[model samples]
Target chain A: MKRIESLTNQWVKETKKLHKKKYRDITNQYILEGEHSVQEALENNGLIDCVITTDDGLLKYKSILSKVSEEQLVVVTDGILKQLSELPTPQEIIAIMKKSEELTGFGEKILVLDHVQDPGNVGTMIRTADAAGFDQVILSEGCVDVYQSKVQRALQGSQFHVSIVTNVALDKWIEQAKMRHILTVATALDDTAMSFKELQLTESIAIIMGNEGQGVSSDVLLHVDKKVYIPMKGQAESLNVAVAAGIVMFHF
Target chain B: MKRIESLTNQWVKETKKLHKKKYRDITNQYILEGEHSVQEALENNGLIDCVITTDDGLLKYKSILSKVSEEQLVVVTDGILKQLSELPTPQEIIAIMKKSEELTGFGEKILVLDHVQDPGNVGTMIRTADAAGFDQVILSEGCVDVYQSKVQRALQGSQFHVSIVTNVALDKWIEQAKMRHILTVATALDDTAMSFKELQLTESIAIIMGNEGQGVSSDVLLHVDKKVYIPMKGQAESLNVAVAAGIVMFHF
Candidate 1:
């Protein structure tokens, strides 16, 4: 196996750059840290560029490491690994993976996020969508990058199970979905909005959840067939964005 | 108003100690940062020991400050306020509040947590319970401290909306709740567990959520009247704890 001992090694320097969104976008690659995430990426046939680990990590994850090709494995010192990691303690293993191809088609159930900012909220919503059997997740232009480490940690490997499409024009997508006879619903509290419980389950549907503070954007709300609200019985003005998405997603 | 200009001032040093759980416990006081949280505590008649802010903060929150008595107000320099804040960018105002008294009576609906360790998860679940009109929340002994800054931020003032009981013994509480004729349901996937959808709504109910890694503790699970599971139709193994709590809370 190849080995890198120096923290200043050219390869180590380049790998560390993957921590930033700009670098990830430029290289079309991101890092997945920890044993579970690395194992999931490997099992899912994620396009892995390489795997980096220490000697201890190699022995600890021997069963998982057996799947990696010798050419794609690199041994590194603990110090080097920590320098490349986003975590404070750093994990035993980290995998460099290429971004998955954009999904072209939509399934029976779809989740659309418009300007949703929190990484944890975005990741949790994606995982919930997967559990709810949603086909695709569409992210509007202003949504947080799903490739960030925080979001990746929150996803817990659901990113591999569901299709995600980013940088979407929500209004255009809604119009296209409507033309295909798919019901598009936005969670909002406008005059025409009705309770989400009143919504009927449809064979093909898309549910749009908005930013944390704001409900669905006005322009996107104008394009959907229905605007629904989750009726809150207590003094809390609204539910957390991720929680609201889960309640709505599981209902159908 | 009293003025504190030095970060090392006796009062400033003492107030800063509230950031630690041990100190918070000793003094029975906690700090609430940011304008929204401080405002919520004030409006809800939270037991305020003092309101600490900079001259700029005082000017910015003039309307809100009008409610605070001169005796309970203190003006501090920007550096002093920063020293007391948890956030990197400290908000203008901070409030020192006494924890609410332990609730003696049970309500119609309750949410019980067993060893839920994540601060964000606990706070979000409490907020969700409030939004669902659940009457109270009981926290197991091993759960994260709700008074922690991270949990307080995630709560967004829901701590003031619902009655919260902390450091609870799950088995004992379950026995007491059962005696009161409340149906206790636990989220788990054991042999006796059934789909949550099959649960019949009762006049009074207590839903127990477990740790992020382990579902409800086996001891607590044995004590509940029913074991329910949220059925997942997709490839994801489980839902995020907070999201799962929201779905179940809203279901009834």
Candidate 2:
């Protein structure tokens, strides 16, 4: 197998750029680190451009490595792996996978995010939405780039399992969803909002989760058919955005 | 106000040591940082052993500082503040608060953790339990200290609002809960476990959440009156521990 020793090499330099959002968007590829994520990508038939592994990783992942094409496998030095990895203690294996194309048509249950910028929250919401059996997750333009490494880690390989569309116009999407006869529910701490426990699930529903500090924006609230709030019995100002999303997603 | 410039001072040394769990336990004190937590502690009538602030903090928090006794206030340099803080950008103010006495006599709804080691998860579970109107949270001996900086941050101001008992003997607590005629529910992914949706709540209940990787421990599960699993419909392995806790807490 060919080995990459020099960090100065064009391939190494390009792969290192995957750590940033701009580079990931430009190349339409993102780095998948750790054994679980790489294995998940392989199992999901992800479009893998290449696999980079340290000497330790080659032995550790010998079983999975056998499935990768000889040309697609490049063993790299620990130094090169460190330079490419986003983690403090870099994992030995990394896979370069093409971004999955966005899906069309909404599932019966949909989750929409409005300027919910934290990468961890974004990733967790996607994972929870998937587990809760939501059809699709659409993020507004102001949300963090879903391809960022922090998000990918929080997603725990569920990103590949779910349908996620980022940089969508949330207002326009909500209008379209309403046109499609989907019930739009806004989650906010407003006087007019009914308790989430009192919410009735329809055949088609789109749930909107808002920013950490701000509840759902007024424009989005205007488009929603109903507004519901999780009853807060304690002094906590608000629930963590991801936790709130999980509660709402699974309510049905 | 007395300004302490020397890090070698006995008070400074003692306060800095509170960052570690051993010192925190020995002194029965932990440093509460940032404006929100300090304010919450003040409002909640927490025992304020001392307050440390940088010049900027003293000026910024002058209104609140007026309420604290002159003897309890110590103005320190920014250097000392940095040394005392865990965040990269340290908060201007830090307060040393005495740990509250543990509560006895269980509330109607109690949440217990068994080896849920992640500080963020522990804190979030506590916050979610509070928001869901649970009466108290009991942490198993193996769980992370609730006073840890990360856990404090995750809890926001809710730490002061909730009754959290750490380092408890969970088995004994479960037995006592059963004796009190409280329904004991274990959250696990066992085949025989009923779906969480089908769970019937009792007037008084204690729900046990488990370790991130390992579900409910066998010993704890053995004592539970019922076992329930969140029904998952997607390819993701499982929901995040805190998310799972939130879903379960809100189910009632």
What's model 1's overall lDDT?
0.92
lDDT of 2 at A198: 87
| True C-alpha contacts between chains kept, each model in order | 0.87, 0.83
Q: Write the per-residue lDDT of candidate 2 for residues B4-87, one digit (tens) a residue.
A: 998788877778898899998898998888888888778889888888888888889988888888998989988888888888
Chain A superposition TM-score, candidate 1: 0.98
Q: Residues B1-252, candidate 1, lDDT per residue (tens digit)?
A: 899998779999999999999999999999998888988899888888999989998899999999999999999999999899999999889999999898868879999999999999998999999999998999999999999999998888899999999999889999999999999999997778998889999999999999999989999988899999999988888899999999999999
**Clash list (residue pairs), candidate 2:** none
What's the chain B TM-score of candidate 1? 0.98
Top model number, TM-score? 1
What is the DockQ score of candidate 1, to 2 decimals? 0.90
- Candidate 2 is graded, for docking, as medium
lDDT of 2 by residue, A50-112 (tens): 998989998999998888899999999999999999998988988888998888677788899
